[model samples]
Target: MINKLYFTSLDEQVQQKAFRAIEEEQRSIGYYTLPDQDITPILSYCDSIPDMIETIAVIGIGGSSLGAKAIYEFVKPLNNLSRKLYFFESTDPINITTLLSKIDLEKTHFLVISKSGNTVETFSIYKYIYSLQNDPSAYTFITDPDSPLEKYANEINASVLHLPDNVGGRFSVLSTVGLVPLALCDIDIQALLNGAQTIKQSFFNDGYLKDTLLKKAVFYAKNHAQFHINCIFAYSETLKYFCEWYVQLWGESLGKHQRNSAFHVGLTPIGLIGPKDQHSFLQLIMEGTRDKSVTFIKIEDFHDNITISDITLPHLETLDILNGLPFSKLINMQCDSVMEALEVQGDIPLDSITIPTVNEHSIGSLIYYYELLTSLVGELIDVNTYDQPGVEAGKIILKKKLRVLKK
Candidate 1:
C-alpha cells in the first residue's frame, strides 16, 4: 500500500503542530460516502453499443477527462476496451486536429462529459466534432440535468447521463464520468468499483482519523507550512497520468483563498516520471531546495519482463556486470539508490507507496487512496475541498475577454 513519514525541526521559537482539525460537517466525501449498489445500467449501455462505433472520443477536461484518461492509459495496454479511445481535453486546435486526423467520423462515437454542462472547452470541442456530422445519435452527453449540455442533448436527440449533485468532477472518478468512458472501452467498471468499495470499507470502517490514508494526510498537513511543495514522482510510465490526476486533487482541494485570519493555504504539487527525470530534476531535488517532500511510486510486479543476455565486451569488463539483469531490477535499483541518497545522504524528507502490481485492482485502490487522502487533507486544513472558485474566476475572465473581442 502507501507509506509516509513526518517530523518537525527548529532552532528557536515554538515547535507546536499548526494544523486545524478537519470539520466532518463541511466535508463532501462523496466517493466513499455514496455506495455504488448497481452498475447494470452502465454495463447494459456498453453491451448494447453498435458495431460501427470504433472510436470513443472522450470530450471533457480536468476532472471530466483526467480520471478517465488515467484509467485508460493504465488499462489500455491490457487490450481491454470495446473501442479505441481519444480525448479532446482542451480548446487547443492542435489536439483537436491531431486526433481528428486519425479518427473516422462515421465510425466514431462521442462521449461528451462535463459536470457543469457549460464547460467552454468541452462544448467547443463537441460543436467542432458535431459540425462534421450533424448526427445527434452519435453523441452521448454526461452532465447535470437542466444544464446547458442536457438541454442541447435533448434538442439534438443525443443520449444523456446525469452526474449527481453531491459528486464534483474531481471526485466523480468512480461515477459515470469515468465508468462510462472505461466501460465503453470494455474495461471492468465493476472491478474498478469493487476496488473502490473495498478501499472505502477499509477506509471508513478502519477508523476515520486513524485510517492509513488519513495518517499520510496528517504528515502532509503537519508539514504544510514549511515543506509546501508535494512532489509525486512516479517510477512507472503507466503512473505518469496518475500524477497529473493527483496534483489537481491536492492543489484544488487545499488551496483555499481566505482561512485562519487571511492566511492562504495550499501545497504546490509537482509531478515527474522517472528514471527519465533523473537527468533533469534529480539534481535540483537532491541539492537545490529542501522545501519539497518527495514520494516515489514503485511497482513491484510488471507484466513485461526483459533480461540482458550474455554480452561479451572484452575491452569493457566493467560493463559486463549489467549482463543477466532484468529491466525491472534496473528500475527498482535506481529508485532504491536515489531514495537512499535523498534520505540517508541529503536528509531530504521522502517515502514511497509500493504497489504490488499494476492491475485493475491496484489502480482502483490508488485512485480511492488519493481521493480519500485529498478529502482528509482538506478537512485537516478546515477548507471546503470540493469547490474550485479559483478556476471559476479564470473562466469568468476568459469569457469577459472573449466578449470584449466580439465588440
Candidate 2:
C-alpha cells in the first residue's frame, strides 16, 4: 500500500533544526493542517452543483490551477466521473480561443481560484468568461477572504470559498483551491486528505520517518552548492503533470534570498517524464553538468496488464522476446535500467519514490511529501518559503505596463 515515505539520513543538529521549522510552519502557515480541516464545506458545495453541469473549467494559473489540474489528469482515466475537467491557465489568445470552443458554457461550471484574488491573468480570464455568460450561479470563487475577487463574487452574488490566509497558492492544493473542483468531479477528496494525513502523522508522530524526511531536506540544503538542480524523473504518463506541479512547488518555495544574508539560495527543480525522456534528457543527465540530483518516481501497479501481441515480421523477429510482455513491465525496467546506469556512473545524489498506485490517497500523500520537503529545505536554507517576492515584483511591472498602454 506504500503507507509511508522513507528517505536518507541526516545529522542531529540538522534534524533538530528541521523539526523546529516544521513546528513553526505548522503554527503559522497552516498548510500542514489543511488535511485535518472539515471538508463539509467542499462537500456541501459539490452537492449544490447543478445537475446539468457536465464540465468543470478551473480558471487560474501557477499555484491556482496546477495542483488541481495535475490531480484531475493523474486519476481521470481510473474513474469515469460524470463531469469533465479542464484548465484555463494561460492568457495566450490561441489557448483561450481553443479551450473556449471545446467547452459549452451552459454545461460548464467555472471555479475561479487565486490565493491573492487580484492575480491579473486569473481576473482577465474570469472577466472574459463573465462577459460571455454573465451568470453568477455559473461560477464559484476561491480565494483569500476579503480580497477584491471575493468582493466581486459577493457583488455578483456568486458562491465564494475562502482559503486560509496563511496558506500560499502552491501550498493550498489540499485546501479549497484543489478540493472544490476535484470534489465536484467525484474525486475522493476525503481519501486524498486521509492519504496526506497519513504522511503528516508519519512525519510528526513517528520518529523514523521524521528523521528520514528531515535527512533528505538536510542533504539538499547542505549540498545546495554542489547539487543545485533537483531533477524529478517520474516514469508514468499519468504523472507528467504531477512533475510540473512539483516543479512549481519546489522552485517557488525554495528559491529565495537568505533570511538574514544577501546571498540567494535555492534548488532548481526539473520535471521529466521517463522512458519518453530517457532517449533525450538522459544523455544530458549522464554526461552533462555534474550539479544535478535525481529523484525517480515509479508506479508499482497500473491495475492493467495488457500484453503485447506475439507477432514477428521476418526482419523484426528479434523483437519477439517482448511480444508477450506487459508494457508496464517494460517501462519499469526502463526506469530501473536508468537508475542502474546512474548509480554505476556515480557522483549524482539519487533517490527514488515508488507509488503503489495512483489513487486519491497516494496522490494526496505524494503532494504533502513534496510540500513538506520544500518547507524543510527552505528552513535549512534560511528563507521565507511561503512568499514569492520575485514573482510579485514582475507582476507590479506588468500592471504598470498594461495601465500605461490602456491610458
Candidate 3:
C-alpha cells in the first residue's frame, strides 16, 4: 500500500510537522469531547424494539448531518435494522416531503443537531419539522447546552444532549455529532471508538513509518497542482457518505490562499461504488480529459459471510477449474486484479486504504487521520483549514437578501 509514488516529494520534516500538529490538535480538543464512549445511556433510550420506531430522522447541516450520514452508511447494512434512517438537512421541499410521507408520525423520533443552535439552514428545517408535528417535544436536540436550541428543547419538553463548545462541528463526529444517532440505530459505538484510538496512537507513536494524514496532504498539494481534482472512490456502498465527509474537509480547508498567489487549492470529491464503478465511471476515469487522483477504500473483512459450494455448479466435471480458490479469496483476487490493471495503465495516480475492520475506533482513527492530513496539506498550500471565513460571508449576504425581500 505504501509503494505508490504519488507522494514522492513528502520528506521526513514535512511529515513530522504534520504529525506534531495533529498530536497537538488531538491533545487540545480530543479529550474535550466524548463520542461513542458514554453512549450507553443514549443506546438505552433507543433500546425499544425496531417495530416501535417507524422512522428515525436526523436534522442538521454540514458537519453535523454529514458525519452522521457517513456513519449511517458505513454501519447500516451490518446492523440489519428494520427501521429506515432519514436525514432532513436539505432545503428541497420535495425531498423533505418524500421522507415525511414514509415516516409514521406517532412512532417516529426526530434528532435535531446543530452546534450553534442557530444555523440558518438547520433552524429552517427545524421549523418545518416543528410545523409538521405541531409539537416541539416530538423532536430531540443535540447541541451546546447554552445554545438557543437547548432552550427550545426545554421549552418544548423534548430531550436534549449538549455538544462540547471547544469542538468544532466538522470535528464533532467523535462527539454526539455521530454517536447519538448511530446509537439509536443500534451501531456498536465502542468498536468505532476503538478503531479511532488505534489511529490516534499510530499518529502519535514515534516509530510509525507511514503517517497517512501527512502523506495525504503532500499527495494532495502535488496532485492538485498537476491534476487539479481529487476524487475519493470508496469501494463499499456503505462508505458513500465517507466521500461526502471528505469533500467538506478538503474543499473547506484547502480551497483558499495564504500568500495571495494566483493559484488556490482545489479538490472535487466523486464517490464511486467500486466493482460498480468499474462499469459506470471507469471509462471517464481512465479516458477522461481531467487529470484526477483517486483514493480507493476497502474493508479487509465484513461482518457477514456467504459461501457457495462448487458442487452446485451447472457445468459438468468442473472440479478442476475451481479446485483451489475459496470464494472470499476469489472476490479479493478479482478486486486486486482490477487494481493491478489500473496501475499498469498508469491512467491516474491512486491510493489504497484498507481498514482491518470498521468499528468506532477505526472510524475515529480515520476521521482524525484525515483531519490531520487536511491541516497539513492546507498549511503546505498556504490555506487555513481551521476556519471557514468564506462560509460566514454567504450567511451574512443571505440575511441581508432576506430582509430586502421581506420589505
Highest TM-score: which candidate?
Answer: 2
C-alpha local distance difference test of each model: 0.78, 0.88, 0.70
The lowest-lDDT stretch of 10 consecutive residues in candidate 1 is 11-20
Give one digit per residue, the lDDT tens place, for model 3 in 1-407: 12233334547687666656655665655442353257666676666434566677888888888887887777676668556678888888898889888888778888889887888888787788777686654677899878888887787788788776577787677777777777777667777776665555555564352455566676676567677677666656777788788888778766775656766566665667677778888788777875787776677776645655545445666564655456545555655766777677776787777766655555566666676566667766766566787888998999999889999
Candidate 3 structure, TM-score to reference: 0.83
* Tens digit per residue, CA lDDT, model 1, 1-407: 54545333331111112112333432544556434648888888877668878988889999998888888898777565668888899888987899999999999888889877888888788888878978887888999878888998898788999886578888888888888888887887787777666667776565442344555666677678887888887888998888888888888888996455577888888998889999998898888767788888888887778888768787888988899999888898998888888886555668787877777777887888778778767766667788889999999998999899999
TM-scores for the candidates: 0.92, 0.97, 0.83
Provide the lDDT at 337 for model 1.
Answer: 85
Off by over 4 Å in 1: 2-28, 207-211
Q: Which residue pairs does candidate 2 place in steric collision? A: none
* Residue 138 C-alpha lDDT in model 2: 92
Q: Could you give the candidate ranking by TM-score, starting with the highest?
A: 2, 1, 3
